[model samples]
Target chain A: MLAPLLAVLGACSQSDESITEQTKSAVTQTTTVTADGPPRLEDGSVNLGPPPGSMGFWTANNGRLVNDPNNYEAARREMNSRVNIEDAPLQPWTLALTNYRQDTFIASEPYTRCKPAGGPRQIMSPYGFEIVQMPEMERVYILTVSNAMSYRTIYMDGREHPAEILRPTYLGHSIGHWEGDTLVIDTVGFSERSWTNRDGLPTTDKLHLTERLTRSSLNDMDYTFTIDDPGAYTAPWTSGFGVEWNADQEVFEYMCQENNISPAAMVGEGRLSIIVP
Target chain B: MKKQYIQCRLITVTAVLAAFYAPYVLAHHPVSAKFDTTQSVTLTGRVTEVDWANPHTHIFMSVEDKSGAVKNWAIELESPIELEWGGWRPDTLAIGAVITVEGPLARNGTGQIWANSIIKEDGNSVFDLPDNILESQLGSRVEGPAPRWPDGHPRLGSEPGQSGYWSVPSQHSLVESGVSVAMDKHGILANIEDAASVAPFQDWARDLYVIRQQNFMKDDPLFLYCIPPGGPRMFQVPYGVQFLEQPIHQRVTVLMGGGNSNWRLIHLDGREQIGQVTGNDNNPLFFGRGLGRWEGDSFVVDSNGFNESFWFSNGGLPHTSQLHLIERFTRVDLNTLQYEVTIDDPGAYTREWKSAWTLLWVANKDLPDHYCQDNRP
Candidate 1:
């Protein structure tokens, strides 16, 4: 694992200075990036994981800090794992819907149908995505690894979103502004055609997502997001998800229709946290 | 060996991957079942109605048969979205126009043809699709708008990425330069040469392709429903397409204005392929699970894992799970986007094949609302 991470760091031409400063012997502690965050490049932008021209490999980290099935197993090893939020504060409606998905074992996910898992769900998609930041045009793109080959464009040009008369799409309209070293994003206007995750966390058109992406270290960009939708939850809920930089990896093409023969033998049941006793 | 083996994995391995497979709902159906490609007919009739819906554009006409009887014919054309891009307006072929068209006859004996080409009485070709037999730069050029954006890409009116809408070449054949052929702003069948072959097909695959083509592509899943044209097929639509680069995210999006009003995202960020990870279920896909990178000015996309549900080419070429595609789109000039694709499917074809064509930038227009309607009663 260290070898691959090292190779990626070396491959990135604009690797943050703090990456090389990562303590080499702290192998037991998964917390790699120090709190100081990454060093800025000559251009003043924090050296986030991979520069625009580079690739990012992320596997050790899941899309969300919460509800990562991979984290369910991670909890057994790391007592303080993030997935311990199996009993987090979710709106009654959101929790009921999610519980229904697991209880009935209905395997309907946005990914299963090859659709964009719209809204903040995109950040959590296991298919992975690449961030292209072009301050010149005042826009950012999050390209995902789905067959629809869809992407979300976050306007950075200080323009207001279109009026409500506009059409809703899989990816609601988005725009961003920078807060010092962090890039703050505000997104709206979703089609609600997708679920938030395999856990069936639902969303609606009223969903307003505010995301703050700050590079916590050379290889780690601490992603803090807040979901504010009066329709889905009683109050705004916040979560922290971490994305590590893997320089050696490149995003691959994904087609949902081909070889999509999901065998019952392969698709085992999910790990539901509800108590039976 | 087999696309990293997720499609053929066992339970323990599947668990590690966290991706599973189930009986997927067939989103699109077969068109060949309704239309017979082996059979074709010509119909010249007076336009009665037009259903400019998504998935397909339908033309209703009353044709006079040899026996002097009038038959109400339903002619199928490509999507209206594609038509709009090819310089077509809603009023281009208004009702009461006398139209001559030819294509495969419907298998159910309905008086219809999945119209391959439609010619108006004024000697104007109204629809020409599935073109691009041979390439000649000098022979085909559709100029874009008056001004280019500051970034060197074509600007379609106010849009930076769109210089203009693309126009289909008038003639699929080499004719005298002075001679003008009627052209309806339609798509072309650019893949006709040996290099465009889906050959080296296994016996069953070969038969499938033959049967599909002979049936006039009626059985194509696209004909049944206007699903997103995945992979290379998305780029090959007759109405042409545009590429927008969003620098903030290091991403490129292929906005396909053809009929679907759909778009494909190309990730410039170098993220690892999902399938390459161990115990990871590299999800099988419709559009090749895709990735994009820039090599010089050309943007190259590498994709694979196509479901056998759809055809990748206009000719209903057959492919299996092993199909791999490398597509290159180079804005060679303001007016031309040089499009090329290399197809490799050992399971379906005998060898790898390559095809190339040029997309003429249509100026002054962005894509209009083109939606494929579901289940017309």
Candidate 2:
């Protein structure tokens, strides 16, 4: 499998490729740490989270759940909990990835090229997103296991959004409702080439959003988000966190365009330079 | 009559926008980074060119090696609307028509073949059946009268000679109306030409299926991305499946027309396979982990985890996530259903092999919305 671990990691790292800022700050301090607690529910039904069929897997440290498989490094701190957005609120000649091309890879983020990382960069990656919950076709799907195998049906049956001449995708056009078990959603027709998350943030084609989600203890998930857009924000912003739930985590089929050498070695502006082929 | 209902609603909106700009409706790849699903090779010779098209369907052929050299290969298949709904016709491979192929090989060494089956010259394999019992030309179409359902099942469609005829609407229940070519699902319409019986691979899966078909199956993630069809290629695709049968909820819902508008949930309980009632920790599905029952009027089904990211067949043929599957369906009268499938997959293949086809009975119809990147093929 993987040729003797790439001949033992190609003989334990040949030229560490300029050490890319000490391996992304040592994989961003093992990716955001913070797992302590605050999400409780063991079938108590006292309300939220663990109740909606919780088996496991959710991040942003909402209530802790990398499900301890020898601590996959504590689910890389809720999938590297987004840090530098260079003070967002932008909208005055936008490009901002620390002020554009400031070290190449075209200021990264566009999922380094596998494309469509879309809104909240798929609720901030590490590959998790899956809500299902079909309440008899009122619809709720979601399904974002990494590069999102294109899902997010949502419609909740009340119907009322399809008009704007349709086509503007990359996970936009969602529409949910329910207020008791919480669930909100509301997305708008997006596709300004979709972006967000590691703040390589750009978005347009009027990208309005809403999200909400709720559930709190069986594993967690408080998720929030707001982000309206007068064309890439100058106002309307709010964000969110907490989504833990890991019952064993099954989305592994990363196929990120197989071995994308991320446009051949250029780790200064955003990242991706592993060349295993 | 109101201007003929606006000319039949403008011919049903011009046949639903000509099926979303139909250009062979696309997407479907994966030979594993170009071939090496445990390697493979067989080749026979002569068709020379087929193309066919729509997401995939190549052909080519030439073979000859051992030093005599003369390669030529190519192969591929599936699409041309799932090989014309399984019965195949576009002359059914004929330039010179010799055929044979086996599959895998490529990882750049290149002759080419994401193939896996094909033996024709009447030895029959594709839409097969030359043996496996052949007799009954219309006698007692299973005696007649069937339409049940108070949970007694039966009632599915097209059963004159027990629902397996096809002057045309294929997926192959039995065809031949003057070479419409079909009958392979163990119904054996062999027709004439020979050679097809391979499926025993595993030398490490024939060298990883030729390094994933010489490096172009690009690691094959659901054929480079239009993912959704779970085993028994979701009833041999020809896009027309619908069976809801809930039986109070023991579970049985299968509604796959192809990619983007999918639905598979078949848990009929007896539990030999079932998981993902709640998601997390990966249940690896592209239609595996099914589990149905009912054998008398026939329903069967089985499935397994499945997630090598696609290709149990379309000739990209690799398998590993262990790959199990049994399937069976049998409507046998009132518009036929038949099916069958086996493929045990000892990690890749060195044993188990069986395949069958047939579906018809579309009746009334209502499934449409395909999506595939809006028309990617």
Candidate 3:
């Protein structure tokens, strides 16, 4: 029995490795198109032209748009401070200490390990995001390309949140309303098991997030988020970003268990590994 | 205190009784209640036509009762592949061949009979009887049950590395128990030291081996035609397989993922002999004869006489008329079954090879009632 079982696993694992290699090759082939002499927008933001004859476009962070590259840190700091943290908690897990620890920062390991970064905070990562809308259901699904794919469904039915309070999940409960061309969303009830960033900033279950999504152009969309959680922050903070649409790519099913590497490492270190070989 | 204790005991008894009777009511509700299992129906009919296809073959017959009322009845038979290997064919019955069939009626209360066996007007059984059938008629010959080491338990010839038991606690996940090991890169039997000692292959059988090797992963015509590869091939497909046990009738229905379709009904009717056969065409279709019986605590089945058109494994193992399979299925516990299959076909293998695996009980869930004809794809 063990012989045949090993044979099947061996076949599937080989397929997983080939798929990963294919993804890497595809990434390398992706051409980065430059901005066609920045064009100004009505909101005072500059628009970079279409990417390499592709319909999708890109925009730099507002403060980072200046000529001096040395002030990148300052620009990033300003952008980080502007993030709305009114309802967003610092960290969801009780194990996370309020003070940041250098040892806890696992560097690039967090994203590669397929760990959930929580909801709205995950949407802020530098990676490209896509929004899939189902008109009949009045819902929108947001997909990200990090090792972990996070999805959030924004309900637009004008119904109140469950009165008894519901359990927190990674995506959280999102309710939305459309104001003219902008879609305003209120989200709460997130689980404390996620990280706020790849650096391991944590969040709590009481985290509340407000987001404004507006399709400012045919190929681009603007996103703004306000976070509020008294347990983790002193005051509310706001952050905004923009995303470009890619019509060619579609979401595929991702099963983390196939040829997982991170769990193997944990098992080697005597951690409780849930995956059975 | 005494009064309260009496009330608690009564509640416990009621709960236990409900749990025991629930499955009985569920199985019989609306459908099973419509048919009488004990009422055996014998029908004499002319073979009007035969649909020699997978899932099961249907023999369209026009029968006349004592009142001379002509009624059309559909007699379900084993696959043509099975029938052909068993020395039967679609044209064996012809258009006007008179035959008698004895079996249970369909649950739909229609004029259909699940033909147990077909008998000729001259009282000759068209199906090959185990005792009188020659090796040629039986097709491939595989080894029967054999004893194993360590407590002298019989070895189940499943592919190595399969898992799961019959009965698992409710908390266990079926996925964990249903793991199947990948075959060796050189194929399952590559490492056998005595491969030369395996059964010798015939010309057509050797051609099948080459075909299977070249087109293992390629989409075959059977899949495109939407035909459910019956029996063992269905179980070994990449998709999941589940067994639904109707304990009241001591019957088990096996469902597989291939085609998301078809099943085997294991009737524990205490009969050992193979049934009669009747067909309307000269050549049999695929998925040959199957006869099951109980050996000690295990259910042993013999299936042979299959067509070579279908691949044996998803990895493209092939077989011919010489493909004889002896499968033993034993419920290890309330939720797990130890499945052992022995492949003996001189036409395909150099020698006899065996594989063993375990099938987990479907747990508290009911097997999805999926019909292939209804599938959108």
lDDT of each: 0.53, 0.49, 0.44
Candidate order, TM-score descending: 1, 3, 2
Ranking by lDDT: 1, 2, 3
Give residue B95's lDDT in candidate 3 (0 to 100).
64
- TM-score: model 2 vs. ground truth: 0.26
Which lDDT tens digits does candidate 2 get at residues A58-95?
A: 44422221122222132334443332243446686664
Those runs of model 3 whose alpha carbons end farther than 4 Å from true positions after fitting are A1-101, A107-111, A124-127, A247-257, A261-264, A267-270, A273-277, B1-377
What DockQ score does model 3 reach against the true complex?
0.00
Residue-level lDDT tens digits of model 3 in B1-377: 01011100011101111211111111101111223334456666676766554334567667654565566667765434345445676567766667777655655567666555678779976643232121122222233343232433332222122211121111111011233333322222322332222224455654554454334223343332334454455544322354433333333344443342333445444534332121012222244455566676677877665556555543345666677777787755443457667788787666666665555443222222222221111
1 or 2, greater by DockQ? 1
Which DockQ value does candidate 2 get?
A: 0.01
User: What CAPRI class is candidate 1?
Assistant: incorrect
lDDT score at residue A108, model 2, on the 0-100 scale: 50
Best-matching candidate per DockQ? 1
